[model samples]
Target: MAFLSFGSKRDKIKKMIEEEKFDEILKMAVKDKKALQALIELLDDSNPGIVGDALLLLSNVLEINPNSTRSHITPELFQKLMALMERKNPYVRENAMLLSYKIIKSFPEVASQHRDWIVEGVRRGLTEGNKDQKGFLLMVIGELGLKELRPMVEELVSVEDKVILPFEGKKWVPLGDIAKEVLEKLS
Candidate 1:
C-alpha cells in the first residue's frame, strides 16, 4: 500500500505495524517528520494494548530504518525512554531498551560520541531494571564488544542469577559459559 493511502489513518498505522510493513510505515513516519512525534505520544498512552503495539512498532521501525529515525533519537527521546525504564510496565521498558540497543548498534559512532549517556542508561537498566531488561542490556554489551563494559559484565557474573545469552528462536544459553569460553581463549 502507498504510504499515504494506507486507509483510515489510525487503522492504517496499526495495519502497517501488524503487517510488519517497516518500509511503508517508515516512509509515512518521516513524512512531515511529525509522525515520529505522534509515535512518541503513543509511548505513554494509558491503554496498555495501544502502548505495547506502539512501542513495538516504534522499535521495529527504528531497527529497520535506522537512518530514517536517526533524528528521532534526539536527546529528548533518550531521556524519555531512560525515564520509562523505571516505569512499572515491563513491556515499555523492554521496548525502550531494545530501541536504545538498536540505535547503538546502527549508529555506533554516534553512540560513541554520547558514550556517557549510553553507559548511564545501560547501568541504570542493569541495576534497577527488570530481569528481561538486564538480559537485553547484556546482549547489547556483548554485541558491541565494548571492553569498557567489561566491569559491568563481570559484576553481573557475581550474582547468583545468571544472565543467559539469547539464541535462535528465543532460547537462552548461560552467559557465564559464553564468557568463560571467550575469556579462556583471550588469556
Candidate 2:
C-alpha cells in the first residue's frame, strides 16, 4: 500500500547522512515533520540492532555540529534522553549518558541552569554505573570542577581501587584533585 519502497527509504536516509545533510536528518527526526520520523521511531524499536543504529545515527548527527543540534534539543528531548540513561541496553545507556555530557559541555550556561539534574545523573552513574561509565563520569566531574560535590568524591576516594593513581607509580592520585582544583579557583 505504501508508495515509497523500503529500500528507497533506506537509501535516501543513508545518502542524506553520507552527504552530511544534517538539516534534512534533523527534520526527519522530529515527530510528524517528515519521512525521517520512521528513522527516529526506529530508535525505540524492539530490535536491539535497530535501536543501536538509530542511537548511533542520532549521536553522530548531534556530534557533527553540537551548536546546530542545540536548538533542536528541546526540554522534551532532554527528558527523553535522561530517561534513556536507564535503558536495559548498556550501549544505549552509555551513549545517552555521554550525550548528556556532550550537551552540557557544549552549552555550559544551559547546563548550569540544569545543574541539579546533571549532578543527580552523575551521582547515579558514579554510584551504580559500571567501571567504564564511572571512569568517564569521574573525568567529567573533574573537568566540571564541582567542588560542592567533594563529599561524594571523598567517599569514592575512601575506596581503595577507585583511586586513579599516577602512572609514574610514585604517588597515588587523590580523588580530591578535582575538588581541590575547584576550591582553589573559587578562593
Candidate 3:
C-alpha cells in the first residue's frame, strides 16, 4: 500500500508541475514529508522542465527550512545536482546553480567537500553564461565571500553590458556594476 502511494505522490507532483501550480507544491512540501520526498525524487526525472521545477522547489524548501532541507541532500543527490549544472537547458542550469548556492549557504560541510566544483561552475558561468547567469554567479561569490574568485570577477568590471534583474523590475543594470558590487563584498 505504501509502495503504491509513492507512485501516486510522484504522479501528483508531476501533474502540479504540468499545471504550473508551484504554490501548491510549495505548501505541500512544507506540510507533507511525502510530497517533499516526491519532489526530491522528481529531481531524477529525465524531462528538463520537471528537473528544473524540482530544483526550484527544493531551493525554496531550503530557504524556508534550512535545517530540515540539509538532511535531504545526500552525497548522491548532490552529485546529481552537479551534473544538472552542466545541463544545456538554461532553466535547469540556472536552478542548479541557485540550489547549489542555497545548499552551500545552509550546508557548509557538503559545500566544502565540493568547493572545487562550485568554484569551477562560477568560473564557467562568468565566461559562458548570459546576463542573468553571470549576475547570479556574482551574487553567489559575494554572498559566500569567495575571495579566491576575485581576479576572475575583476576582469568583468570592464564589461559594459546591462542585465535584466528579475527581482529588480524591468530595469537593466550594468554587469560591471554588479561585478564591482561583488568585489566590494568579497572581503
Best by lDDT: 3
**Local distance difference test, each candidate:** 0.62, 0.57, 0.79
Q: In candidate 2, what are the lDDT values of residues 17-95, reduced to their tens digit?
A: 4566657666555432233444455555565555555566666655665654555555556666666665777667666
Winner of 2 and 3 under lDDT: 3
State the lDDT of candidate 1 residue by residue for 32-98, as single tens digits: 3556556776666666556666766677667556777777766677777777656666666666666
Model 3 scores worst on lDDT over the 10 consecutive residues at 163-172
* Model 3, span 19-133: residue lDDT tens: 9999999988877778888888888898999999999998998888776676677767766776776677878887887787678778888767767777886787778877767
- Local lDDT at 33 for model 2: 27
Q: Between 1 and 2, whose TM-score is larger? A: 1
Error of 1 at 99 (Å): 2.2
RMSD values for the candidates in order, in angstroms, are 5.5, 7.0, 3.6
Better model by TM-score: candidate 1 vs candidate 3 = 3
State the displacement of the C-alpha of residue 61, model 3, in Å, after optimal TM-score superposition.
Answer: 1.9
Ranking by TM-score: 3, 1, 2
Model 1's C-alpha root-mean-square deviation from the true structure amounts to 5.5
Q: Give the TM-score of candidate 2.
A: 0.57
